[model samples]
Every structure is written in structure tokens, then in C-alpha cells.
Target: MSLPFILFFVFALISVGGAILLIMAREPIHSALALILVMMSLAGLYLMLGAEFIAAVQIIVYAGAIMVLFVFVIMLLNAGTEERTDWSKIAKYAGLPLGILLLLELAHWMAHSLIGRTPANGAGSANVMVSTRELSMQLFQKYLFPFEATSILILIAILGALVLAKRDE
Candidate 1:
């Protein structure tokens, strides 16, 4: 087996385990830590796929900035361990099968869509490196509205959090 394949499996397993941990953890802080582990492993996977810029953004933006915000909110709220809830019979019986169906549909769609597509390299190679300048141009030119909207949404979330905090005091 190739080294990259093995590394992919390792990172994939770590990410999946971290996701499970994130879901199962009772404490909000522990869940946040697990999410950080998942994000870092995803960054490693991105690096393995030759997306160095995306990997760096994943680590810096998600792991560093976003996680700090999440941790700060958790601390500010004085969040405690989660209380166990009893699941309804309908959810318990139907949710898993519906989730599995959704997963299978997604897999089918991805398999069909990616079957014969080569990486966007003109030379038909897999290691196409997207320059930062090109990426910025695409982001600013094509995706400007969506990007600005996302920032506004985040700002609103921050303001909402502050309002809730003030109300509690």
C-alpha cells in the first residue's frame, strides 16, 4: 500500500472517532475539544490531497478562531454536562433507517458524479495546485455576496449570544 493511502485511512479514522466522541460527550467543553480533533484531522486529509492552502485555512480559521469562539461562548454560558433525554419511539425506530438511506443516496450521487473526472490539471494530472491569487479572485469576484452574507450571519450570532448573556445577568 502507498504511504498516502495509509495516511488517509489514519486521518479518516481519527476524524470519524472524533465525530463520534463529539456526539457522545456529555460536557460541552469535551464536545468542543472533540470537534477540534476532527477539524485538525480533516486539515491533515486536505494536506494529503495537496490542498495546502485549504489545510492552512482549516487549521487557522476553524481550529484556531472558530474553536476559540465556541470555547468562549461555552465558558460565558457556564455550560454544564448534558442531561440524558428519553428518545421517542418514532425517532428511535425511524431515524437510523432514514439516516442510512440518506447516506446511501449521497454515496450513489458522489460515485456517479466523480466517476471519470480527472483533477482540473490541464496535463491530466492529479496534483493541480490552485494559486492563492486565483482563489482570492474567485472568492471576491464570484462568491462575494455569499461570503459577505456569511460574515453578516456570524456577526448576528455573536450579537445574539451577547444579548442572551446580558439577559441572564
Candidate 2:
């Protein structure tokens, strides 16, 4: 097998394992760490797909900044282990079947969509290298309004958070 194929499997396994651990961990801190592992593995997969800029953004924005924010909130809140609740029998029985059905549906959709599609390679591939300047130009020129709106929304959220936090003190 090719090196990329092997690396893909490795990253996929780590990502899946991390997701499982994130769900299963009782402690909030451990779950956060597991999420970080998942994010990093996803970044690796993005890198293998030739999306270096996306991979770097995934690492820097998600794994670094977002995770720090999550960790800080967890610590500030003094979060503890999750409390277990008894599951109703109907939910216990129905949830598994429903989840399996959803998984099967997704798999069928993916298989149908991918069956006739040829993987792109060479110059025709979608993985063309784009310069940061071109990317910034597109972002600022074409997507400027949406980007600024998003920033404004984020600023509002931050201000609301500060107000709530100050109110609590």
C-alpha cells in the first residue's frame, strides 16, 4: 500500500479512538484532551489531502485557540466527572437501532455518490496550491460582508459573555 494510504488509516484510527474516548470519559478535562487528540488527527488527515492551509488553520484555530478557550472555561467552572443517569428501556432499545439505521443510510448515500466519481489527480486535481495573498484577496473582496458580519457576531457574543460573567461576580 502507499504511504498516504497507511497514514490515512493511522490518522483515521486515532481520530475515531479519540472521539470514542471523548464520549466515554467521565472527567471534563480528559474529554477535552481527547477532543484535542481528535482535532490534531483530523488536521493530519487534512494535510494528507493536500489542504495544508486548512490543516494549519485546524491546528492553530481549533486545537490551539479553541481548545484553550474550552479548557479555560472548564477550569473556571470547576467541572467534574459526568453524572450517570439511568436510561429508560425504550430509549436504550430504540436508540441503538435508530443509530444503526442512520449509519446505514449515510453509508448507502456515500457509496452511491462515490461509485461513479473518479478521483482527481495531476493538474486537474482540486488540490492546487493557492497563495495566501490570493486567498486573502478572495476573502476580503468576495466574502468581506459575511466575514465582517461574523466578526461582529463574535464580538457581540464576547460582550454578552463578559456582561454575564461580571454579573455573576
Candidate 3:
């Protein structure tokens, strides 16, 4: 009924619908696009929750960079639309029960959280990385080595890809 609740439902529906479409889409590219819709809707939900940094990361990293990578890989592989196949009885029947269970869990969580929660004026104390100061402090002081290690790992992966592409004849 309230604005925030309405917005939450809107974004939640968009995210869930996108996820379903992503799974149902036959083409790899369409699936990737559907995933982008899900990611962007999740970013909206993050913004609604006052997690600005996470929302930005969701948009920039997952929707922007990762989706681009997914699209590129799909194109590079020349992936085609999936061929329709007969589904097993177990798989077809199992989906409804699983969906209902997930729905019940989500309803329980929302009922608890929305009933008594007040909106924080800004990112709450528990929200790490809400500001650049905390993020930079942790990044440079605490997690610097891991950050550099991941960068090195990415470089190695790029080199491996190049090597594989230019294999000696």
C-alpha cells in the first residue's frame, strides 16, 4: 500500500519475471538480455534498500561488465537457440512444488521484515562500503593483497585465452 512497498513489489516482480524469461528463452543472447533485466531490477531493489554502493556495483559490474562478457562469449561461441525436447514427468511436476515452497519462504521473510522495520535515513551502521572512506580504508588496509591477487588472476586468464587463440599450427 505504501510507496516503498509498492516499489518493492514492482521491482521484485520485474526481477522474478526476468529470471523466468531468462530460463525459458531459447537463444543464448536472449537469455543474456533477460539476465541483464534481472540484474538491473535487483539494482533497483538495492537502491530502495538504501544500499547505494551495492546498487552501483550491481549496475556497473554485473549488468555492465559481466553482461557484456556473457554477450561476447555467446557471440564468440556462436551459440544457437535450444532445440525443444520432451521434459521428464519428474521435472515437470517438481517445479510447482519448488515454486510454492520458495514463495512461502519469501512471504514469511517479507512479513517479518516489513511489519516492524523503519527506513533508515541513510545507509545504516551495518552497511559497509556505503561511503568511499570506509571502502578505501578496508580496501587499502585490510584486503589489499586479495585485491591484487584477483587482478593477477584475471591477467593470467587473459593470457591463457590469448595463448589458446593463437595456438601454433
Model 1 C-alpha lDDT per residue in residues 1-169, reported as the tens digit of each score: 6676778899999999999999889999999999999999999988776677898999999999999999998998999987987887888899988989999999999888866685542221235656678888999999999999999999999999788768553
For residues 72-147, what per-residue lDDT tens digits would candidate 2 score against the true structure? 9999999997797687787789988998999999999978886668454322233565556787889999999999
The TM-scores of all predictions, comma-separated, are 0.78, 0.82, 0.72
Distance from true position, residue 144, model 2, in Å?
A: 2.2
Candidate 1 positional error at 97, Å: 0.9
Worst 10 residues of 3 by lDDT: 120-129
Preferred candidate (lDDT higher): 1 or 3: 1
Q: Pick by TM-score: which candidate is best?
A: 2
Better of 2 and 3 by lDDT: 2
Each candidate: how many clashes? 0, 0, 0
* TM-score between candidate 2 and the true structure: 0.82
Question: 1 or 2, which is superior by lDDT?
Answer: 1
Question: Candidate 2 has which clashing residue pairs, if any?
Answer: none
